[model samples]
Target: MQTVGEVGERAMIALFTAAAAERSDNADDVVIGSGDDAAVLAAGGPVVVSTDTAVAGRHFRFDWSAPEQIGARAVVQSAADIAAMGGALTGLVVSIGCPPATPVDRVLALNEGMVRQTHRLGGRVLGGDLVSAPVVVLTVTSLGSLADLAPVTLSGARAGDVLAVSGPLGGAAAGLAVLSAIEHGADPGLAHRFSALVDRYRLPQPDLTQGPIAARAGAHAMTDVSDGLVEEITTMAGASGLAVDVDSAAVPRPDGLDALAAELGVDPVRWALSGGEDHELLATFAPGDVPPGWTVIGAVGDAGGGPTVDAQPVGDLHGWQSFSET
Candidate 1:
């Protein structure tokens, strides 16, 4: 086993998990698998289930993201995912893996984060398990109940639907750029410029409340902006075999984004178009207008169609994928 910051927390957990995956028993009563936050059953009333994760090197860094931040972020993100399905969270569970040499306080800090985030989202931790690993990994699962039978789906976008987004864009992209530059040994002054954006990326302001609002507002299709806008728009368009047209000039820029873009030698538009992990909600509506906190960005044109900025093609329809190099 490597000792003392020899490897990132995520790598250690993956190694240990790989070893553990082989030790599974056939008799374990897993109503669901070991991926999402909470498992499900026929104890059913249309439960909303979601899973979120924080890795040592990828999702967060111990040197940057505090232990509590990791826990809170995991819970918030999982809760956001459930809310995307128009479900209100009822409970949370964390499956935590940590190095043996890790400080116990850090673990407590992690749990504290979950509790804080759970309270923020109006939920609580039911129970969970602790395990030994080489690095720190947190996986939070959340369960919610659907008020109505209507569940928002990304694949249900319809042509002529209004394409809209809740909250600002380019912020998370700005933040992630900071983290990546820091990892590459950038100067502290430059990294600090991305602090807010980075925090937004690490602790996303998932539009949990807005999801149901959109669902209730005759939303034809809906999803969170976990991926970049164009990528997500393309995802919905492709799912419905429809085409999307976006007005690049219409997207609202977050504060400090233009300055940050100039500092990083990037286009604010590129960040908005191709950025990922913002977790803002992107929904399609056939109604005449937008709900609160939403901005009109474009319209759905045809099936298998793509976005047009001022009637021009946006960036390549593909957004950044986690395992793929951008």
Candidate 2:
């Protein structure tokens, strides 16, 4: 187990470059690959860009998550932002910071995870920088192209639009709760019974394909559910100058959540509303225009100034804030 200090920066860069080169399905816009000062990419129409950072202990625990899982998570979340804008991915630029004592194999595994996830979306890593630090930090910047379609903005929702989601929600938040319980010495059988929730938290499978699908289907507004469902809907409503009315019963909760919530003695509906990081696509569409995969959970109404569920304003609306004391 060689440490990063022993391998040195140049050697580490070579290792990462080789790993990135293994991804064969790079987009045609990737004119220049890794091992350069900067990557050169071709742009056609509007270029959508987004960046996200994940810090160890804050975003994840090394003891609970494999290095690859951490890496995959960082990539997926950043890529989901591009998808929210209804763009097809072009490439990614990754920058990693870790302690010198970190194992070289761990860094390599992290890169492998990034490669695997990016390749899944028909993209590849262009280049990145590795720096010595006190803790593990990964920053991924994703670039995408909108082709001929207009990029969906959060303010495009009309008063009569329908609010829909591309996939299930609340699974990641439940997974987080399960992991915390396991850390506090919960029964192993509990973990075995709800392994799917744990896996959802470990590595979220965001429906990246649906972003473009929703855009093509005439989605007026869109955003990713990285924050809790209510928090994001509030943002959309505020931006669009409309009130969003959510049918509490119509909101899609993940499978096995009711049983798990009962065991934990918590409200499953609250989890679905407030639990963040599901990374599902939340979009607004005209009546009867929602794509086949999206589930209509609510509707937009005349500006009542905020979001309401079951015709009542929600209290305690909060999600994954970078500075919140959870």
Candidate 3:
């Protein structure tokens, strides 16, 4: 079997280019796609760009997730960032670092995963780089088109705005807990009951369409739940000079999360509030302008120093930070 070193960088690029081409619609903006040294993109108005990284043993494990899942997860998170900015995805540039001894097939599968996920949002992989490393490291930079829409920033939130989320929260964290339990001798049968959570951890499906929807609905500020809910809300509050008050009872949890939490002797609400990587959109809007799909969870107040949950100040408002102790 050929390893990455044997197949070489050019060959690897060829594989990725072919995979991207197969899945891409060849949009006119992507005039120069993956085969080139750099991709050329044309935008009618403002373009939003964001980048995110995933690493082996940190972001994921090959034993727990397939290469495709890893690729999709990386792409989804980056796309979610663009979505958070109230933009529609246009293209992606993915760079990968892996051991030279890694199998070429694994690399191809990773590229396929990125291609597949981008294709789902009507986007394509424009270009990227490959390098040898001690472990797998993937970085994705996503580009989006605003289409003349004003970009929403965390600073746009104001006092009296309502807080809401576009989709379910805490599912990814719950999924991680289940995976941990299985690793430590928990019953595998439980997997049948929590399959959605497990799948979510492996491959998060962010509501990419919601970003533009929220923008159209006049969202004042927006962010994705890449970190825990409290952490993100706090960041937004701090940025906007407002105090966000979350109603814990109103935070939406997945359908079976309560049952799974009961089985694990964990608090479902805590997971919903503190779990990261859900990639759900959290936005602040005028009370009467809350979008149809969003679930209202809280309200913004004049800056009283920080954020609160149920009228009390929040403690331990931390989330996924790279290099922080797990």
TM-score of 3: 0.98
Query: Whole-model lDDT, candidate 1?
Result: 0.72
Across 1-326, the per-residue lDDT of candidate 3 in tens digits comes to 88999999999998888887765565778778889878888878888999999999999999888999999899999999999999999999999999999999999889888888998887889989999999999999999998878999988998889999998888999999998999899998777789999887889897889999999999999999998999998899889888898899999998789999999999898988888999999999999999898999999998765789888878875667888897
lDDT head-to-head 1 vs 2, winner: 2
Relative to the true structure, candidate 1 reaches a TM of 0.82
Model 3: how far residue 14 lies from native, Å: 1.0
lDDT of each: 0.72, 0.89, 0.90
TM-score order, best first, reads: 3, 2, 1
- The alpha-carbon deviation from the true structure for residue 64 of candidate 3, after best TM-score superposition, in angstroms, is 1.1
- TM-score: model 2 vs. ground truth: 0.97
Worst 10 residues of 1 by lDDT: 18-27
Looking at model 2, residue 35 earns an lDDT score of 91
Query: Could you give the candidate ranking by lDDT, starting with the highest?
Result: 3, 2, 1
Q: On residues 234-318, what C-alpha lDDT tens digit does candidate 2 reach at each position?
A: 9998898899877878888888888999999999988888888889999999998999978899999997557988778877866
Q: After superposition, how far is residue 271 of candidate 3 from its true place, in Å?
A: 0.7
lDDT for each residue of candidate 1 in 213-263, tens digit (9 for 90 to 100): 887787888888777888887777778887777787788777788888888
